[model samples]
Target: MKSLVALNSNDPELYLLLRHILEAEGYDLRLLVDVEDLDHLLKVGRLHAVILDCTPDNESSLICARLKLGGQSTPVAALIPSDGNAQYMKLIKAGVDEGMLRPLAPSRLLQFLRHQPNGASADGELGVLAEGKSLRQHVLEMDLEAQRVRYNGRHFGLPPIGFRLLACFLKSPNRILSREHLIAAAWRDTACVKQRTVDIHIARLRRRLHAITGSEMIRTVRFVGYVLQPHKNTRNPGSDVFQRG
Candidate 1:
């Protein structure tokens, strides 16, 4: 399931632009223009992040106050005028998790929503992301703590590299990751492993997932890469509501 992000902005033009862009990044969004609407969404406690337009004076402070009042740890980013440092400090003191300069760039917004610090985009998060197994279901579970995967009441341990490769797939569900991308993720850039090494590891990883779950979760993309196929009925209600009524 994708994360839910609320955009509370005063600018209709910018709001419309951000809506489409964020939605494309796989977020469930709620556009809130009214204070009452923002309050309601915060109280619901389902929002993972909030994009607040600081165009109006004190609006950022009020929004941050409301989030604090609701006692939810939801992150907030204030979109302010790019002219001065005055508004920047105001938004920072108002408790916004991040601040963005106007004339928004695509990567800036993406990094803000994804909580990437130092302007680090998804491309830089390759090997760092595949260290865990947070997405598990459909009678198959990958436990990072135990370094083993469980399926059909049986436990299996993947080879060291195989585990890393599977963790990479688990981190990147539904995204087409190329063989080169997989190689970069599972192995350091020492130029030692060839592209065929990635294929071998993928084949082994698929066998592990299939042996346990009885379903192939990874799919090949001819001339491209691979993607993790999710279960038919599995959905994270916390993040995704698409599969829900």
Candidate 2:
């Protein structure tokens, strides 16, 4: 069965509303009133998505940001009160895929569930492949099923966030990736993050890349963001980077 976790620290009434809507649709609902619970849940495995209630105190954007920083690919949907604009853009910047205001229409809610990638099996989904068993050079190859990085015929291990960030650069090679873009691509929604968090992760990635290759394959375009540059000689015979414009 598909699982959907709900994170809302302050609103029981809203929780009740979500329970009725998702349970009726046959989703296994895991209710989390506090954000800390999300940390533990994320460590276990991926979920279809996380639905967060937007409030004055606990915003969905922060939740989304932290999730991306930790490398969880689950999509996030933010529920705002039915009223004015309510800073939906903030949620987008934080890494939320879709933002809806309550009372949500049944059709729209169903559409969101149906389109989520988390429910799909691996054979039907995309994947990341590191370059051919190398960690020293800056270039990493990505495809629908694998990611590989090559350096002297050796491979380096990368965590999920590192892999996602590197893959984003491989797809865009020398182009400057602003923190906002990196966060969006890496997180796939902007209702839960801050820009500074992106910077910190980038710094960590740079260190790891340098340690392996002894050269800065990833560069910072000051006042802009980071760029990926692959080594000249190391190329995988079968992999080509895919870019989404």
CA lDDT, candidate 1, residue 37: 82
Task: Name the runs in model 2 displaced over 4 angstroms.
Answer: 24-26, 34-139, 145-167, 178-201, 204-216, 231-245
Question: Residue 31 in model 1: shift from native, Å?
Answer: 1.9
Q: How much lDDT does each candidate structure score?
A: 0.62, 0.60
> Which digits, one per residue and each the tens of the lDDT, describe model 1 over residues 1-245?
65678887767787778778877877767887666887787666577678877765436667776775556556677665655356545555444555556666667677655542111122323237434434354444566544456654587755445656776776666789988777766654324445655666677678767766667778999999899875554434453321100
User: Which run of 10 residues does model 2 get worst, by summed lDDT?
Assistant: 121-130
The sequence of per-residue lDDT tens digits that candidate 2 reaches over residues 1-245 is 55655555477776677678777776656766555778767666667778776666774667777775667667677776744245555665565555665676766565566555444322222123323332222244333233334454566645344556776776667789998888776643344445765775677678777887677778878898888775554455543354331
- Give every collision pair in model 1: none
Top candidate on lDDT is 1
Query: Model 1: runs farther than 4 Å from truth?
Result: 43-45, 116-245
TM-score of 1: 0.45
What is the alpha-carbon lDDT of model 2 when measured against the actual structure? 0.60
